[model samples]
Target: MGVGLYLHFPFCQQKCNYCDFNSYAGMEHLLPKYLSAIKQELFLYKVHVSVVNSIYIGGGTPSLLAINDITTLFDSIRRNFYVADRAEVTMEVNPGSCTLEKLKVIKMNGVNRLSIGLQSFNNESLKKLGRIHTVEDFIRTYQYARQAGFDNINVDVIYGLPWQTGEEWQDTLAGVVELDPAHISLYSLTIEEGTPFGRELKAGKIKKIDEDLEAEMYENAVKLLKANGYEHYEISNFAKPGKRCLHNQIYWRNEEYVGIGAGATSYMGRVRYTNVKEIPLYIEKVFGNDYATAEKEALKLDKIIGETIMLNLRLLDGFRMDDLTKRFKTNIDQLYGPTIKVLSNQGLLKEEAGMLKLTDHGLMIANQVFQRFV
Candidate 1:
């Protein structure tokens, strides 16, 4: 398999309340320099990677770039990497940031998939989340993407908001199903320490929904999406048949990929590393030294096995013991048989037809199961 390439654009028009990513707001002044730094960073990886099968342009809203800048970015990628002809090229877009002209330009430059950030269909919820777009803006953007010839599209939604109700959650699912996007990603809200929601939670101004209610919301989403012909391929992702996000599958399968731009991570040659998070520092290091790695770790054999199991179990289909043995050249059962047996007896996991998978109950407390391997 060829290496997957991920490029991060860290600029957003306005940062959302719940975001704690490497993204920043009001960085428009640095756009030109940032793109230049990204191109330079891509060049530094040319000697290391020979073939790239997938290119994911994720961000702080990559659609916020200007027309010419987008074209230039793709041109630089082609210049530096041997991109496959049938590569899955995906770009993350926000509703208010994309226009019909911009979408057309993006398509013409070879982006075949788009992951739109439509966190909620309700205008009130959108406002509460500090989203810049409304229901109308999202609808218009989705329509524009379809008109621009993108058939494989993914819609991102979040459940478990501070004041969300079961009915409202169902309505969001129904609304997205009506749109019939090729894929859907469902995420439960997590209040990280530095985000606005986290502060509100700390101040006791906002409260998390009841744990039971959150689980019910997830269960309802699974049923509703499946009934609409979407496959629950991953724990948090649903897809129409043959439309799964290929780049993410690389990570889940514990394969190698290269990451570019500020705060991006790469797993190559059995070593994992992340780039510097600060934009100015990233630019300086990339231009001055041709690399901007901030931290790295070389994996030991046992560590690799543990991490591989942790990532693969996220797929609903699970991984085979035989496959694990073959990949790592070791006896899988000898290493983890006892833990598996214990988990199975507790009804948190099951093994059937040589495949090991999570039971329905296991999916709810997946973190606990993963902790066993860790």
Candidate 2:
């Protein structure tokens, strides 16, 4: 089985008010050390990983990385890893950070896919979300990416923003459909505890939208994107036929992948581990050849099965019971037979074709079903 490689870039021009990702705003100066440490971490893999089918350069805006650093990162990957010829290499780009010159260089250096984070089409919503890019800037950057010869594109949009009207939400969907990107990721806004949005929410300065309103927005997205020829392949992802994200699918399938760079996580064999989040410490440790590993856990069989059930349920196509039994040596029902039966009785889940999947209503309150397994 081929592995997926994830490299995290934790530098951004500014942090979004809602972002809780392990990214820093004024840490651009740490790029060189971070890149070198990532390269070293790549060689530290002891397992005999033969081929890689996907490489996702994700994070605090990978497009902001210097061209030379980008080239060096890819060059090291090519030299050390047997990357497949048609591997889906994706990089996340933000509108304000991407330039034609930089994007072209990244594209030419083996990046076939670009995921642009365009949270909203409304300039007012963009400002409210503390996003640096305007609607026009996103348009220009997207057009520039296409001009740079990227055919496989994904656009990420968020709905249910504070005080967002249905008309505004529909406009955002229409704008994305007009772009016709190969893939689209639609998400409802969630308030994380430490984010500015969360603080504002706690202070009663900002209010969370009603659950019914959020559900309506989500349902609208499903209908609109499906009508536009995009398949709702995952709970939050839609793709044109054969354009589903392979890297993310690996995770959904509960397969192993090595995540490199600061604040990265890796799942190899039965163990799951994460790298140190602190940049200076990560650099020092990797340079010291300790791989900057912060913590590691050998997941128990029950926990693994719980993870399998939780992750696979997110996919629309679902997963095979026979395959899980083959891999984990555990019967399907033993893992969550009682819970599945309860959910099925409640019309939150359905079983057919030797596979189990979430129902339409189940998708609305997926967290409730997911919590049972956890």
Candidate 3:
């Protein structure tokens, strides 16, 4: 299979309360330099292939770019490498910033998938989360996407926010189902230090609910989405039948992908590379062919297999023994013999239909299971 491509745009209109992603609130002036550096780095990883099967342009909000900038970026991709005609080109949008006119331009520029950031359908929750868009804005954005003829779209929603009730969560899920998006990403709220939520939490102004309540919310998500005909493909992702995120699947399968822009990570062949986090430094390095990649690790084969098994288990279908053997030259039993046996005996993992899969209990306690492999 061909490699996947990931382009990061680290600009947002306004940072949300709960977000700690490597994004900035006001850095629009640096976009040109950033794009030039990104193209330069893309040239560095020139594979022989003319096209990759998937290209996901995620961001602080990629839709924030001007039409000309978007055109130039896609033009660079077309010129620099092979892009399959049916390549899943995704662009992330914030409902407040992405107007209908912008969505039209993005669609015309060959972007086939849209991932809208709509954390909740409640106005109060939106305010608490520091989101700029209201519930009505999300509705309009969804309508505009459908009007623009984008059938493969994803909506990102977060649960377990401050003061969110179980009934409110059900309402959010119901609103999402009414939109009928192809994919939905359900996230549990996490308080990251340095974010607004974190600061408020430390000051005792914003309190985190009980862990049991959060788990209940997660279980509620599964039940609600399943009832709406969305398959729980991965722990946090649900899709309509076959609408899984291909770029993400590549990551889960331990395949190669090229990441552009500040703080993006790439795994190619067996080496893992991360770009410099500082935007100015990123531009400086790329301009001089000294693109200051912060880290590079040559993975050992045994270590690679272990990592692969760990990521692959995140999928509901689990890992294939045959494929695992082919890649690692050692079967799962050889490397993770004790771990697998213990998990199997505990009914957390099992061999079924010639593949290893997670039990219902396993999915809930997946991180614990993965720790054993690591």
Candidate 4:
């Protein structure tokens, strides 16, 4: 399989309060220079990566780019790499940031998928989350994307907000399901240390939702999405049959991928590396040296085996035991037999028909199961 490509656009119009990603607000002035630096960075990897099966343009909000900028980015990609003829090219868009003209231009430039960030349908919840767009903006964006000829669309939603209720959560799920997009991603809110929510949490001004409530929300999502004809393929993702996000599957399967842009991480040749997080520094380094790698680590065999298991278990279908053994040229039973046995006894994991997978119960506390391997 060809390697997957990920390009990060690290700018947002207004940073969300709960986000801890390496994205900045009030940085639109750097868009042109930043894109140019990305092109230069891609050139450095041309020899190492010859073919790409997927291209994911994720961000702070990639839809913030101007038409010319979008055109230039794709032109650079085609010039530096051999993107597959049927490659899955996806771009992330914030509801209010994208216009019909921009969506049409994006489709014309070869983006086959659009992941819209529509955190919640409740106007109050949107305000609490620091989202600039309203429910109306999202509906407009979705309609415009359809009119622009994009059939494969993914809607992203978050549960467990500061004052969110079960009824509100249910409404958001129902609204998105009614739209019937090709894919859906449900994310539980995490209050990261440096984010506004975190500070409020520390100051006793905001509280994390009760753990039991969060779990209930997740379980409800699984049941609802499954009944609505969506497959629970990964922990936080669901898709209609044959509509899974191929780019993310590469990560879950522990396959090779190349990531471009500031703070993006890439794994190739069993070595993982991340580019610099600061946008200005990233651009300067890339323009000056054609590279901006800030960290790199080469995995040892045992580490790779453990990490591979941790990653593959994210897939609901599980990984084949035979495939693991063949790839590592070792006995799977010998390495994790005792651990697997204990987990299986606790009903957190199961092995059958030459495949190992998480049980329904295991999906709830998957982090703990993964810890046993890693």
lDDT of each: 0.93, 0.90, 0.87, 0.94
lDDT of 3 by residue, 329-367 (tens): 677677787888899999999888877988999988888
The C-alpha local distance difference test score for the whole of candidate 2 amounts to 0.90
Order of all candidates by lDDT, from best down to worst? 4, 1, 2, 3
Deviating ranges (above 4 Å) for candidate 1: none
How does candidate 4 fare on TM-score? 0.98
Q: For residues 1-374, what per-residue lDDT tens digits would candidate 4 score against the true structure?
A: 58999999999999899999989999888888999899998999998998999999998899999999999999999999999999999999999999999999999999999999999999999998999999999999999999999999999999998798898999999999999999999999999998989999999999999999999999999999999999999999999999999999999989899999999999999999999999999999998976799999999877888889988999998988789899889987788878889999999998767779999999999999999998
lDDT of 3 at 15: 90
TM-score (C-alpha) between model 1 and the true structure: 0.98
What does candidate 2 score in Cα RMSD to the true structure? Answer: 1.2
Q: Please, what are the lDDT tens digits per residue for candidate 2 over residues 48-102? A: 4778989999998888888888899899988788999889999999998888999
- How many backbone clashes are present in model 3? 3
* Residue 24 lDDT (model 2): 88
Output the better candidate (1/2) by TM-score: 1
